[model samples]
Target: MELGSDLNAGEITIAQYLKDVGYQTGMSGKWHIGKEPKAAGFDFSVFFKSNGTYYGRQINDEGIVRKVEEHCDLYCAERSVDFIKEAVKKEAPFFLFHNTQLPHMNGDLIWDARKETKERYEVSEMPVAANRLDDLSGKPEYLKSVRNLSQAKVYGYPDEQAIQKHTRDYYAVITEMDEYLGLLFQTIEDLGLKENTYVFFMSDNGWMLGEHGFTSKVLPYRPSTRVPLFVIGPNLKPLDLDQMVVNIDIAPTILEMAGVLLPDNLHGKSLLPLLKQETVNWRSSFVYEGLGTYGGALPNLTVINKDFRYIETFENGTLEKVIFQEFYDQNNDALEVNNLMGSAAVKSKVGEAQKLINAHKNRILKQ
Candidate 1:
């Protein structure tokens, strides 16, 4: 039922999948995927919207909009924690999907938290990204004029000061989120649900704090593409994994965890093997995609591997036609400051990247 070439456009979600197998599903915070949580089979939902304000937040609860007083993220967390505690009392297993707005800087971009938490970190203390000073020479021209809510204050200032302030606030907001997560985790611990519950933490996307002089996501850059993923549950060893992963795998992983039969058309592989410390042959790389922004920016796709990232940026004017290609040697240039596209030195690796992209396109367009 996934119509597009993008496999991330899922028809059956993890919630729907789990619901079929008998699990109590609940969700809070942003549901950006167009459909409401009920449509996707969640029994209980809250505060779900595409994006908006923090305080005086308008949250949709079973089709009713309730104006909330506290910050949106904290309010959602408190409700989610309460749901977790109450849900376990029932006979069914529960899956509480807790999403927070603390880290999200979209739309008028509320950079807010508790007063003490926001001021806890000094601006100088937060370490800026290595590519924070990127001049945008290799980037598209239209991106320069994107003065929307996410980037107005971020790109309006002088370079270093902008990066410092953005990074400082980012950390500040994350610190507040950490406090909320601590509360949620403690609830799980106290309720004796740690052994049975699997808490998977990840974001839809990562932001660029002046990386390549950009303030928002939607670029093929690592700063925008790479996100922190944490999977915690009983009998799972805690260790760093260098394997390539993506958000697509989340649904399939959940189904696998719940002992459901995997549909053959799934575009993602489960991480259960990896979590059990078993040796499994996993994907060497994957594609990063960004659809054009309301005729403003161009649609771009990148073939990303451990050692290299190759991009094919399409024309904004024509949309379908390729305008330019970029290749980064991620080994030597981890910050992605250098573009080796069409360079004679990396032609062989570039060829491999092209093949990868072609194969991925074929896989995506199977419908």
Candidate 2:
């Protein structure tokens, strides 16, 4: 889908809003939001719009385009530590957003990791996803398109052979990233910021290692959308909540932690209550939107709740026709091999999913 122009100060970012409340803000990581981090009111920032290289990445600091030869994860960790040491000297509250660009596709369309890390996960040791050998007969036509299968074809990712070759590399990248994070964690403990900082960990999206015989994201499948979420803070016990959470909730959760007022127009609510182990009413499902054109899957909407996965494919937004519908009983079909849409007993369940889609459309009209 098309996005608006670059973000400006007219609309305050989370970093900018935090700065207004006397908190020094800084960020170091990948930012593809169509605006410079400095323009968003970050006190100090360092990033290079790299073309998928792990070393010799270019950086346009101010107006100077310079290059650095550090591994991306190491480079980011160094910068984050630098900012933390500086913030400690200032003797005030600070917000640091340390993002990493790892376990993501590189020039070869596969995740890149250190050679040693990759060697640790032998191809024979890799575990293929449950739906690695899925046949797309029950899925929409768009999912079976050659264009959408580009990544999968690059490494035989449509089956277990693909998982053996690619998933190991992906895990290696993540494990290397985890090592660098240990450095950041040490910095936090060394600087005594552990108690005050509430670290939130999440991914932009999940990946599919041959899930449903497909690779890459933008599908209505569980492996394509179920990202990991982790929260760590002082005095906070680990409790996994069953509520549906999305990336949009990150801002509201952070704002609530920083005591900032939430903007009413936000699409997600703060997860702070749930994080605190509070018994509160929460959403049962979330809408997974997939908007695409050439080289991507067809436009679609999916609602994944506690017990079901419902998908509706569209004709690329022209509203010419709905290709079809799919429903999977999560409780009985964790692998999503069974399409429950045609079941006679679950007519009401199908209707409920349709209602969610209709409600979202009505909300858009009101906006």
Candidate 3:
């Protein structure tokens, strides 16, 4: 149940809570929360690394390894389907984390369900959070200061034809995921379990095929930080939450959804009240820190407050360099082009944000 990255990226830790709740918890595909699956506390697990083909492979569950003959998509989906069948047969509330490797990258597998045409894939439109060119339209000076401006240069777009081809493969994976999701949803509906089952669909983080002259998700840009979130259930209303919600909020949301009491030690906020349309005050700022050993030695610390984002990059003992410090009036420049951090008018605001980030770190330490 432990995904490699954040809880939102994959259903890693959420799966752990499911097992803790006495549900028949099972996970298949990329349990990357830690080097060992047992560390995350899962009854059944399938772990994979970050490289190579993400499909037609094997997953290690407990101490035993299980071979999957099908592509990665089918491999995970089928296992989840079987879990659901078993759960229904046993009248047990099952928790199945069917994490997939599709629509992520290194496209070798071709999935018809995920893509239809070259154009759909060429633009990388299949991703819910594709990089928008409009975001970089302004701030010519900032763009110039940053290295690697071309899409082809940044995200390895390859040739025009190659990008189109890659896009096709990417879309195929997305479509395949969408189809499997529909199938899973249908199963619950057909079994008359719609009222009880809650389905949450989201990407771990935004994947960048091109936009912003960037490729992967290590950056603090919206294309990487923003994730698509949707919860569908019988009584849930369709709502778009503009309020800032970080990946940390997910753990508590799932815990609350399962009708479990919030563990006081957890660092996430439950979205149960939000789901019920209760006007509860939520976290206004999202603190982002890409610290730890992953994503190379390029470390970054960013804080996104009401209308400003302060990004500090460091290497070894070098002083912190303000790679990107901007304040965008969400009501106006939502794309975040204005670098108000450099302006004298916003010095006080910038100082306040720094204090907030410092306080946040202190709170985490005290916890």
TM-score: which candidate is best?
2
Put the candidates in lDDT order, highest first. 2, 1, 3
**Ranking 2 against 3 by lDDT, winner:** 2
Task: Estimate the Cα RMSD of every predicted model relative to the unseen true structure.
Answer: 3.1, 2.1, 5.2
Candidate 2: deviation at residue 39, Å? 1.4
Q: Residue-wise lDDT of candidate 1 within 1-367, one digit each (tens)?
A: 2222222455677788888888989998876655677877788888556566777888887578889878788788887887787778886788878788768764676575567875887877766666655666775666667653235354554357666766777788888788878888999889888898899999877877766656667677887789999999989998899999988898788889899999997888999999998999999988876655542557777988899999987876433577888888989998888888768999998888878776766665664
lDDT for each residue of candidate 3 in 190-286, tens digit (9 for 90 to 100): 8888888887777777755555444556566555677888878868988887777777787788778787777776778887888889999987887
Window of ten residues with lowest summed lDDT in model 1: 1-10
Q: Compared to the true structure, candidate 3 yields what TM-score?
A: 0.78
Clash-forming residue pairs, model 2: none
Error of 3 at 60 (Å): 3.1
Give the per-residue Cα lDDT of candidate 2 at 354: 86
Model 1 per-residue lDDT at 294: 44
Better TM-score candidate (1, 3) = 1
**Against the hidden reference, what TM-scores do the models get?**
0.91, 0.93, 0.78
CA displacement after TM-score superposition, residue 231 of candidate 3 (Å): 0.9
RMSD of 2: 2.1
For residue 115, model 3's alpha carbon misses the true position, in angstroms, by 7.8
